[model samples]
Target: MADKHNDISSTELRANTPEQAVLSTPTDDIHVANGAADKSKNQKIRKATNIILIVVAFLFVFHLIADRYIPSTDLGRVRGFVVPITPQVSGEVIEILTTPNTLIRKGQVLARINPRDYEIALFTAEQNVTQAGQNMGALTANVTAAKAKVVNAEANFTNAKVQSKRIFTMVEQQVMSEADADNARAELASAEAGVASAKADLAKAEERLGSEGENNTAVKSALLALEQAELNLARSEIKAPTDGVASNFRLKEGFYANAGQPVMTFISSEDVWIEANFRENSLGNMQAGDKVEFALDYAPGEVFTGKVAYIDYGVDWGQSEQTGKLAQTTGQTGWLRQSQRFPVTIHFDDEEAKGLRRVGGQADVMVYTEENSLMNLFGKFWIRVVSWFSYVR
Candidate 1:
């Protein structure tokens, strides 16, 4: 009976298959559900895209305003005068008076070389100077005696002129013979010859002693050598040039310090400044003397005050130094170029920043170029926020 009913149902379904079917199969229901699901998915995608666009736009607008009014940069460094301490005179380091990371004052003795050798050099120089002076003084006395002889000769010549004139007058008046006049003329000529001879002797003496005269080149050279020796002896004891912290010390007792070679690095605390790289667009109103706020990575939750000491006119990007040859410019790979950064030097207004500053340390800086209350307030708050963020940095 079931088989007969199934056969009858199949025949009825086939007969009503054209367009008059009252019941639907499960395949058609599945197609309709898939269509609804696809439409819902597309709607969700569009909504998400709109939300993302809105967020991006908001961020762009916020950045533009913040950067324009309050120019701030995280690419900042705590900078100061980093002096390389080099010994002016070379010697074996006998004593290291300065410890690493300690504050050093200007002119403080940092290290001492084996000063015994320098002391010997100084003594030798002094002795040589004294000997040269004594030798040159004897030669100088000869020249002085020669000059006196010349003066005496000139005086005798003058006296001979007067005597010759008197003798000529006596001969002319017939009171003396022509022989007396001739003898007077002969004496005058002899006196003139004596003067010439004395001058020649003086010249010869000067020429002989000039090589090592009292104030001659040799004496001057000896004096200069003596001065140089003294300077070298003083330099054996190395002194600090500026107040700073001695760091990265590479010297110890028994070490040999070469002349003009750096032994340690001195990070000068004097004139501490921040070198902040800022985008060109943000520097529209930025210039020297502008008020600035900054923070350091070492001191989190603390902001420092400063001013724009100066702004770099340009950067050295893609630039080669003068080498007497044309620079072969290299082509960039990208279709667009990135914004260039200029260094803005900020000087500390408060002494606290100078005390806490370090060379090449990380910093965040904000320059207040304009008088916008909103921007200034935001900049102050932003710097503090950055300061707190340094805890993680």
Candidate 2:
């Protein structure tokens, strides 16, 4: 009975020891606490990510709204009116008075053609004018002499008629011979012919003299030719038509310049402007007088201000390509069609445009619309950032 009792007590002790060891172990509790801590940290991280995504989405929407209202163009260029220097008259270039890339004033003599021929022509024209004046004087003298002759002829004719009439009367009274009466009739006929001849001479003299002595047809024609000769002489000296710089001037002393051919290019600095190309969809709010900010590659990091001067009304899309009488359509059709860009002219501020010689230079432009919003400030900031980058790019 004592051995059985000892064995049962040992078995109970072993079972109770195993249960106590399981309850007092600290490894399971440590694992459960670590899991709870990991779950809490994950929850916090997810919350932060969700907040960040929401903020980014909101900012993106705002940016879209701002960009939709404010139009901008990455493709812009400095433009100005290019004046082609063309000669009006054809001649050999005898002298070039202007140098290439030199500033010239209006009416300044740029070059000279061979003026010897023109001078000779002018001299001939002057001689012709002098000869015409002498002829006019001679014609006047002739007219005076003819008028005097006409007066003398009229007097002689009257005297002859009177004498004939007296003779006829005498003959009728039987105091004169019949031969004398026949001779008197013959004298009357001669007097009538003399009177007609005198009247014709007077008419001829008046016709030659014309209404005004100095304004005779021949004299007027000669004077017009002289004026034309003088004009041609003056045109032989080519003159600048405007205040600008002359470019591409390759004319020398002996080159024969053709009439109406462009010899050089004149770029007018006073009429400089910018031509910006904007997408068609971005011009909904654009109007004349809108403010513009632009950056030129030549003037990097400097933002120049300008105002919208005009918007092109016509574009190539609406233009019809004519194939004979039929209007062939040139409209583009594709899944990824390119957006058409139209030109907008911007006039720079006079003060800011000074000292900038960037004609046909690349530029980036941004147009600020009338719409006001908080995002517009951001848009301006972005533009400023781009301008800053322009320094390195």
Candidate 3:
């Protein structure tokens, strides 16, 4: 009985011990080796992540510094269009040739005025010119006739003088009658009077001819009349001055309009540009002739190019004179004031602009005054240098 109990206990102990021991052998060894390798790998990964984060932080800080030192402005409100139109004559609207928002070419007829009155006035003026010319011609002919009369009068006076002298000699010798001599003397005096009359008539004719000659008052009146006629004729035709889209048509077809009244206005679509108003403080690095890059709210995915063409000389709120003193609130610390804004006009160099489009569309203009990093840094440095130099000098 004792031997049997001991054998069963030993068998149970061996069974439990062999299975447990065999199962734990490879697991324990593998667990120890894996733990060591994982610790090493985790340390390496953390170190690498920390190093990458540090580099990224440094780069971010550098970028912040660069942005603060460099001056930048968002000028998005500057835009304008060219207005080119003028009325040369005044008349009543008789015909309408264009509608609102219609595209018109250069020299296209825009409207017509009532031409009947103008045409009649032109005809009357032409008649006046023709009459003046005829009067001048008639005066010139009279001058020639008066000159001939003067020559005939002179010859008659000479012949009468000779005959009178002969008659006086005969009377002095008592071979001729006194009445005859007296009559001859009277004839000679009458002939001399005729010459004076003819001379006076010739002078009058010459004066009349001169009055109607070129550059004379009568001729000037005629020319003025002709010009007025031509102007009236021209007033009948209303034409566009340039290629543009018509707008603001206050007069319509068959509408009666007076002189100096505007019939319509047009906007050219080809000359569009952006006008950016940047703060005065942001102008330190800005200048004319700088290239610009810009975008528009209307057209997306399209990049536009332009050049800075002008900058305003001064800044003003453009308040009316009746308004009181102007002031603005800027968030800043005491003892310093914020800079004001001024306007700058940028011209687009794109083919779309050169094609005669109406400018004045709203756009944002960012001028690239400094293309390189070094240039941007040096520009700021130069401003500070000039500031210091001003104090020293």
Best by lDDT: 1
Residues 286-386 of candidate 3 have per-residue lDDT tens digits of 78887766555445444466788888897665434555666655456765566577888778785743432334444544556666656455444433343
All candidates: TM-score:
0.73, 0.78, 0.68
Q: Identify the runs in model 2 with alpha carbons over 4 angstroms from their true place.
A: 1-60, 67-69, 205-214, 318-337, 355-357, 371-385
Residue 24, model 3: lDDT of 50
Over 82-148, each residue of candidate 2 has an lDDT whose tens digit, in order, gives 8887887678999888897777788989888887877888899989888888888887887888788
CA lDDT of each candidate?
Answer: 0.86, 0.81, 0.71
Kindly give the stretch of ten consecutive residues in candidate 2 with the minimal lDDT sum: 20-29
**Clashing residue pairs found in predicted model 1:** none
User: Which wins on lDDT, candidate 1 or candidate 2?
Assistant: 1
Residue ranges of candidate 1 with Cα displaced over 4 Å: 1-58, 128-140, 154-189, 204-219, 319-337
Q: What lDDT would candidate 2 get against the real structure? A: 0.81
Candidate 3's C-alpha runs over 4 A off are 1-74, 77-92, 211-216, 269-273, 317-336, 353-360, 371-393
Error of 2 at 171 (Å): 3.1
What lDDT does model 1 reach? 0.86
